[model samples]
Target: MSMDVTFLGTGSAYPSPCRGASAVVFRTEGDCWLFDCGEGTQTQFMKSPLKAGRITKIFITHLHGDHMFGLPGFLCTVSLQCGSNPTKQCVDIYGPVGLRDFVQRSLDISHSQLVFQYRVHELLPSHDQCPEGEFKDFLSLRRENSVDPEDQGRTIYENLEEGSYELVADEQFTVKAFKLFHRVPSFGFVIEERGRPGKLNMEKIKELGIQPGPICGKLKLGATVILDNGQKVSPCDVLGDPIPGRKVCILGDCSGIVAVGGAKLCYDADILIHEATLDDSQMDKAIERGHSTPKMAAEFSNLCRAKKLILTHFSQRYKPQELVTDGDEDITVLKTQAQSCVLFGQDVTLAEDFMTINIPIKKNN
Candidate 1:
């Protein structure tokens, strides 16, 4: 299976003529997971090949308007789509405290009814304070309350006062959330795909006088088979080494260095999607506003030894080619500066609206 990331909006704070605000979609296994839904994000979705209805989960970075203003509208659109089709699809939203209330208030005030049910999993600092293995039980509590109609929306916040819950876990992949250092409560997400079994060595099998038949299938399943000549063969004897999985780290708006937990979450990531809302010369301004500059983003990528870096959330002041009169350079200069800070020969690219990057599976050597 292939995993692809689509940048819906790449600008920061506000929408510009060439860029919108913060939003990206991670598509895999025919499901779409959205990160940040700033203003005009729904419109951007309409422009791209992605369907808003395919978005099963949304991870909001923070409560900032630039990061979440389009949420209510997008929810309404999805509700309308589900209403027309009458499906039993449910959308799960994960974010900091007040997210559920903000979404509920928006729907309530507009008197809009959703055809499909949606759940909001709020991440609290108390959850971060819990002991390591304790969060599993806390997550189980949240899951239990999900079935109760009265407790559906408010259960996670009310019941889990001192623990955090798992964002996502399945056979194919797992997603973990870590707190980010920002002006308000924020989060970063790390997605790790499960390692796949080794491939059957067809050349070796042919060498062993095995034909392309049921025995090959059995060998692929890690079974031992005996040939008609009484030769026993195990899968490990013919199979190659297992293929390692891919790691993707998507971070939210934050200052210079990520939190220790966040850094660990990003370690050795195949791709690092980070916010570069300011130029190198604006370090003080970035610190004051709790945002990262391009150089800082590059440095963070280096610290994590990320194989690829994609920078987003650019300030509106940066045009495609024009230099700023206030000492800030254009996007090209920013990209160049960020590349300089990255480890030698690593891939680094700036994210543009509607750009799609495919993460191909690596073959075992």
Candidate 2:
């Protein structure tokens, strides 16, 4: 089984010649989960080979125009193409406050109606006091709601909020949400492959000279039973301990440091997807914009001990070779530095629209 990430749009505040706004799709089990939807995202989706109708969830990082402008168009286009009821399942929109009203307004004004069902789950803050000053601009829309940490961390009916990890949705795998440090209230997501339940060791069972049938099922059910011959066996004799799953963390704009406990959520991820809107030389600029530089992205990835780092949300100033002169040596130099940190620091990759990246998980020996 493979879980992969496809970039629908990788541009910043505005669209560039080669880049669009920020959007990515996490594809697993033939289903798609979207993160952020910038303008022209539907066009970008069509360009990619991923099935447009497979999208089941849309996660918005913030209410920034660049992050959400394409949503209305994308939804309407999907409705037009799929004719409303593409599938029986509903498309859930998870985002900050005002998302439902915003989408509703767009639908009402455009006279667009979706064929499929939709729901909005908004995230709220803990108190009236602001946690980060960066979020001041977005308070008007978000202050009306609040998300309980306990509610955010529970997975599959089991409450895991006691630990740093909490489950989001789990079937074959589990998805978790961790709050991040964006200028607005935002959350970073972690999708992990659920570990398979331990199975009875067939060879051991065979060596025991036990006839397999309901006995095997009983053993798998963790029940100790006496067989026809009065022989007793325990499930512990055959089953193994539960193993951990592959972890991938997706972060929006954040300060590289662990100040204010915001960085605690991202610890020890296998892959960290972070925003790098500026270069190292523009550290002050990054701070001013409440964004991160490429170096800062790398630094946070390292801080989290993330096995790999994927830098995204590049500024509109950057251009591919021979495209434009708006980009300078500092931008190129910072990119090089990011790449060098991994192998030559060249491990840092600049993303364009429609680029897909597959995370490599360790194979069982």
Candidate 3:
């Protein structure tokens, strides 16, 4: 497992008494990224340990109200916090086309003055005739009709491995988006960390008479060093295998993973957060409505070789487990139905509001 993923909301379509909407936060020491911003998300931040002010990037899977209606309000709230305390930061957002207009219009209508700078990068569908890297500024939306969110066959990730749809990539990690089939144009996101340096063998270093200096540091950087005694020391002699990066997939409400094609982006993910909105008994209706059942989610997780599968975006009919204290975790029916579909004992977790999963880094020897 990895570090932390907190569910700010888990309900589908709308906010319920037990759940907010569709929102999740992935956080590390000095950064925070929000997956969705449903209504009351700011209030959810107040209730959870996640601070609202630290959101530097936001990824919206679609234009649905439940998935992004709160974005404008949350942005306003964050701006208010900064205005009062005087902190300067920028918020970068990514989503399907028309999202920028919606946000700008909402902000304009409300006249909410923000103390920070925020930019929305819209992901255009593959069929768009517009050339790559030549998209005019979002202000161009003012002169055109709204791009339909449910335009059939609309998708931004036609080629996942081309590295063209990357949203964030830095020294530590990368974030990319892939298409999803849904009632509305939807997407799934993957967060991948760069490989880390292998652990050093202290005993071997001591045996080689290597002191804690630039020599050891260069070895960690996979460079061979020659000692003052004219002996050659190789990195392989002291360093274990490099640690593979973690890959996490967070998806939007969808009927299924699209038809197989080029290399699958979600293959072998460390954690997969998928929407299992209905029970197996409602399989027919689930797909008709552009949703998935526990069995569907479990099968997808297995197909992708995901180490951990988290099922979320539950239907309102699935009430809390009887006599449960705060909320349902380890839901019985979901587990029972999904267990059969998950091969090789892949971990399955039923998501609840405020549920947090701590994942550890993968180690290699």
- Residue 152: error of model 2 in Å? 18
RMSD after Cα superposition, model 3: 6.1
Clashing pairs in 1: 127-163, 127-164
Tens-digit lDDT string for candidate 2 (104-214): 679879999888767666654222212454444333543233755333221222122422224356575566555555555555666777665475789988887877898
User: By summed lDDT, which 10 consecutive residues of candidate 3 come out lowest?
Assistant: 149-158
lDDT of 1 by residue, 107-158 (tens): 9899988888788877764333223333222232333333564434433332
Model 1's TM-score against the true structure: 0.84
* lDDT score at residue 8, model 2, on the 0-100 scale: 76
* True-vs-predicted CA distance for residue 185, candidate 1, Å: 1.8
Deviation of model 1 at 78, angstroms: 1.7
- Count of clashing residue pairs in every prediction: 2, 9, 4
What is the TM-score of candidate 3?
Answer: 0.86
* CA error at residue 253 for candidate 2, angstroms: 2.5
Best by TM-score: 3
Model 2, position 40, has a per-residue lDDT of 79
Lowest lDDT sum, 10 consecutive residues, model 2, at 151-160
**Backbone clashes (count) for model 3:** 4
Query: CA lDDT of 329 in candidate 2?
Result: 33
Off by over 4 Å in 3: 127-164, 259-263, 323-331
